[model samples]
Target: MTKVSTVTIGALALTASALAQTSIAQAQSTEHNTAEKDYRVFEKTFGATKGKRRNHTKGFCFVGEFAPVDNAILAYSNSPIFSSTSEVNGRVSHKGGKNLSPDDKFGDRGLAFEITTPDGDYHIINVNTEDFFPASKPADFIDLVRALGEGGEAVKALAAGRPELQAYLAHHKKNRDTTLRPYEGTQFNSVNAFYLVNESGDRTAIRWSMVPSGSQGIVVETNSDFLMDNMNANLTNGTVSWDMVVTIANDNDDPNNAAIRWEGEHTRITATRLTVTSTSTEADGECDAVNFDPTVLSDGFVVTDDPILEARSQIYAHGIGVRLSEKE
Candidate 1:
C-alpha cells in the first residue's frame, strides 16, 4: 500500500511540472506574437524615408485638421500619422546689424493644435523639437486625419501597415537622448535634452520634456532622488505624458534645408539636483562618481562622464561579460 501511494504521488508531481512548463512556454509565445504585431504596425505607419532621421524612438509627426471629441487625438494615433506657427511683440530686437522684424522672424515658439469634440475643445501645443510631437509630410497628414474620422477599421488597418516594424521590434532599442558632449541644456527638469554642436562651438539645441497628460510643462524640481523615483513610477504606471521638443534653424529660415535644421532648447534640469556619473577603474576596483562635464579615458580604465558613455560601459562590462547584475 505504501509503495502504491508513493508511485501515485510521484506521477502527480511530474504532471504538475509539465503543466507549469507549458504555461511558461505559452506566455512567452504570446509575448512574441504581440511584439511581432507591434513591429509590423510601426513600419506600415511610418513609411520609408531614405534619409529620415530617427525621432526620439522611431516615430514621425505631421500636420492635420482634427475635430475635438472625447476620443479625437487618441483615436487619430490609432488610425494614422499625417501632418505649424505664430506671432510677434513690440520690443525692438536686433542681431548682426540687422533690424529684426519681430512679426516675420519671431512667432509663437510652438504650434497649437485644436480638436473639438462633444465634451469640449482640446488644445495641444507641439514644440518643434519635442520627440512626442513628430511631424510628417502634407499628404500623409490628410490621410491620418481621414483615418481618425473613419475610425475602427481605419485604425486597425493602419496599425497593420508596416514591414520595417519587424526590424525595429527585433532590435528592441530603447530611445534615450544620446547627444554627444555637454551644452547649455543637457539635463533639465527631470527630462533629457540635446543639441547639435558644430566645430565652431555653436549648437542647435533640442529638449525632451515629459509631463502628465493633463498637466502643464514638466515640473522642474531641485532633488534628483525624488525626481528619479517619481519618473520610474510614472513610466511603469503608464501615467499619460507628452514630450516637448524645440528645433532650431541656424542662419536659415527655410524648413526644407537640412544643414540649418537642428534641435534647440535651453536648460535641461535646473542646477540644484543635477548629477552626472562616469566610470573609472583602478588596479584595485571600479568607481563611479559624479562629474561636472563629460570625460573619456582611452588608456588604463576610465570612462567619459556622459550618460551615453556610461550606458555603453555598463552594457559592455556588465551585460556582455556578466560581471554585474542588472539594476533598476
Candidate 2:
C-alpha cells in the first residue's frame, strides 16, 4: 500500500474548505441579480429563439401523494412532508426548448414535483440522470451552454484543446449518456446539495433521488406519443411508485460538486415512497399554473452554498414565464 502524507491530506482539507467558501459567496452574489437578467443567460443559451422557452418544452402532468415510510431514516431536517404524507402535483417532461412530443428522443428528460405542506409548497425538480453536466458553478454552466449552442465545430475544438471542456466531458460523459434511459427505469436526482439541519442545529449535507424499484431493460423507439401512452396505460392498472432515497455525504465528499456521484460507502436511506395515482394532459394539469422552483424548499432543509441551485431556480422561473406568455 502506498503511504499517505500528512501534508497532502492537509492540503486537500484546505482545498475543500476554500471551495465551500467560494460556493457560499457565489450563491449570495447570484441571488442578488434580477430574475430577468439571471434568466436571460439561460434563454439565450438553451432556448431555440430569443425570448422563448427551453428545448424540451412538452410535458405530462400527474397528481399524487408522497407518503413517508414507516421505517424511514430520520435526518436532521424536519421538513413538514417528512412528518406526514402530503398531496403532490407534478410533471414529467422532455428536456429541450422546442415543443416536442413526449416520445421525441432529442433532449434530456425531467421531473418537477410540488408537495403541499401547511407552511408552504416544497418543490423538487430533477432530471432523469444520476448527475448534472459541465460544472456546478453558475458561471461555468453558462459557459458550457454557450459552447454547446455554438454547434459541433466549437465542441470539437474544445474537446481537442480546451482544458476545462476536456475535463468536464471526461467527468460527465457517463452520466450524460445515461440520461436517455426509459422513464420507467430512469432515476431522477436532486442534483444540488442541501443541508439537513435538526432542531439542535446539527447539520448533514445530503442529496436525494427518486429511483425506479427495478430495472426494465432499454426501451425501443416508438411513436411520437409512446411515453405518454405508456404512462397512461400504467396508471390505468394502478398507481406507479418510486423509491425516494436520500444519500448522506461522507466526511470527504464535496457537497457542491454536481458532477460527482456519491457511491459505494455513502449511506443511502429510504425517505419515502412517491406514488403517481393519476394523470392529466398538460392543458388540464396543475403543472401549467405552478412554478416548480427547486429553491422553494422547506424550513428544515436549507439550500446549500451551491450556486447551481440558484441558477436552476432562475432558469425554471424563466421557463414558466415563457410558457405562460405563449398561451396568451
RMSD per candidate (Å) reads: 25.0, 12.7
Scored by lDDT, model 2 comes in at: 0.64
Report the number of backbone clashes for model 2. Answer: 8
lDDT of 1 by residue, 1-328 (tens): 2111111212233343453344345435544344333323333443322222111111111122331122222211221111111110001011111112122222111222222122222222222222221112222323443454466578446536532222222332354443321111222221122333333444343322322232222233423122223333333444322322223324433333111223443233211111111111211111110111112111111221224323222222211111111110
Clash count for candidate 1 is 34
Residue 6 of model 1: what lDDT? 16
TM-score for each of the candidates: 0.20, 0.78
1-328 per-residue lDDT for model 2 (tens digits): 4222221112233343453344344545545454446556556656654322464467788888887873445556677777778877788877755565547464567887778765545545455553644565666656666667788777767567545456657666644564445565567778778888776778899888888763333444566767766765666654477778888899987787775556668778888877887788866675655667777766677887787777777666545545444444
Error of 1 at 276 (Å): 31
| Best-performing candidate as measured by lDDT | 2
User: Relative to the true structure, how large is the alpha-carbon lDDT of every model?
Assistant: 0.25, 0.64
Clashing pairs in model 2, backbone N/Cα/C closer than 3 A: 54-96, 54-97, 55-96, 55-97, 55-98, 56-95, 56-96, 56-97
